[model samples]
Target: MGFFPDLPITTERLTLRPFTRGDVDAVLDYRGREDVALYLFDAPLSREECALAVQQRILQTSWSEEGDKIVLAAVLSESDTLIGELSLIWRSEDARQGEIGWIFHPDHHGRGYATEAAGALFDLGFQGADLHRIFARCDARNGSSWRLMERLGMRREAHFREHALFKGGWDEEFVYAVLRREWRNGG
Candidate 1:
């Protein structure tokens, strides 16, 4: 069986599943917004870009080697409405390390969906993939992102100042991580 034999992982309120062509519109709703794209590496996506992105994500459901990434659509279980996206990258096979990231629609902010979804990802990494460590990085100015990381029991491992130029200026970054032992030990 594959790392995650379960295709659609269900949380209390959301489901993390592979992206589909039908998800273009829902995904575009947030990916096309300027505010949502602010901290992201790219600018707001156009319709065509969103469509192509979904096409790419559709094939990113598996992991077999270092650098391989799996992207999942976070959908509201009751409505099957796509509200955000999450990703896990196999950073190192020898170190058993991975990276996690998430981007949710602003409308869904303040809800516990992101935290729940992240926890689910942590499960997949630690249990499903037998990973030793999973980490996440975010712009230091993004309070919500870091706060969510903390809520997931990930500790701030690094604070990089002026890490690189982002959005036309120097940007600071924060890296948060949690070990498999900690995750399994109730934090």
Candidate 2:
């Protein structure tokens, strides 16, 4: 993979940027909610935990080698509100593949924020980072996430049944992906 670009990728309505110390409160406000933590791997975090998480995210702003993960805070341009978070994980150096994921506050749902932010991450992964392929995975039950993946022009590549046990039950997973060529051709 190539070098990661600088911070703060601006969309028409959102800013994709590094997490800051000041964002800790907002992070806890959203991430601490039970509804928001339902599908997440980790349980709802407390203020102290969120502060540490934000600190770690701040440190990740400096792009490192392949396999390093970059986490960006999705903020509303007008209000500068931290609405969500997006991540790109360099999956493989030789294969030039990466994985992307996101989490948004429930209050901001039904809007196009996740779609817009994720699309920008895809563009950065393929065009800026020079990755050959980028993919995303979500719990099959999470209709909104998979739908957003489809809206971003990624094709459904795989579906694993009862993939894992989560939240005291079985969970399926769907994999969606797009290749550099496919992205370039506007697929």
Candidate 3:
């Protein structure tokens, strides 16, 4: 399938590429932090778990089927530092839609790295993958995530109150989406 690229996608200051074994330490460094895992569905990972997660992501970098998920490591071009990650989950082949998500090291926050990486993922989903629509969701309390989604020109489509049990309690969720036509029209 033409769903994935073997080469890394380079942005002005970042490079979006597949995860490698060498990236485990960086992954654990960030993903192991409580702040980073606060909004995530899973708890903070240990060193071994982070290694396995990296291996899983590396495996997902190649998309041989319609439902394959693509996960990219966002590295700072200047330093080649793995600062964060961006992902596009193939939601429906029939609907031509996908879902996106992201995470970054707390140390890399406030630098616009997440937004830049996410925008690249959006372009890949809509233009590269020829998807009809792309959407993202985050806990309602994740102001930074939702704000970045907005900055990427995604419209807030829904706010599900107490959508599901998260972290042992009910939490609201915000959904943001953008259509291919909208993206092409500079949405």
Query: How does each model score on TM-score?
Result: 0.96, 0.94, 0.95
Per-candidate clash tally: 0, 0, 0
lDDT of 2 by residue, 88-186 (tens): 998888898999999998899998999989989988887788889999999898998999998888999999999789999998999999999898484
TM-score, candidate number 3: 0.95
Question: Of the candidates shown, which would achieve the greatest TM-score relative to the real structure?
Answer: 1
- CA error at residue 19 for candidate 1, angstroms: 0.6
lDDT of 1 by residue, 45-137 (tens): 999999999999998888877888889999999998899999999998889999999999999999899999999999998888888999999
**Pairs clashing within candidate 2:** none
Shift in Å, residue 81, candidate 3: 0.4
Lowest summed lDDT across 10 adjacent residues in model 2 is found at: 59-68
TM-score of 1: 0.96
> Which ten contiguous residues of candidate 1 have the minimum total lDDT?
1-10
After best superposition, candidate 1 residue 78: deviation in angstroms?
0.8
Give Cα distance to truth, residue 70, candidate 2, Å. 1.0
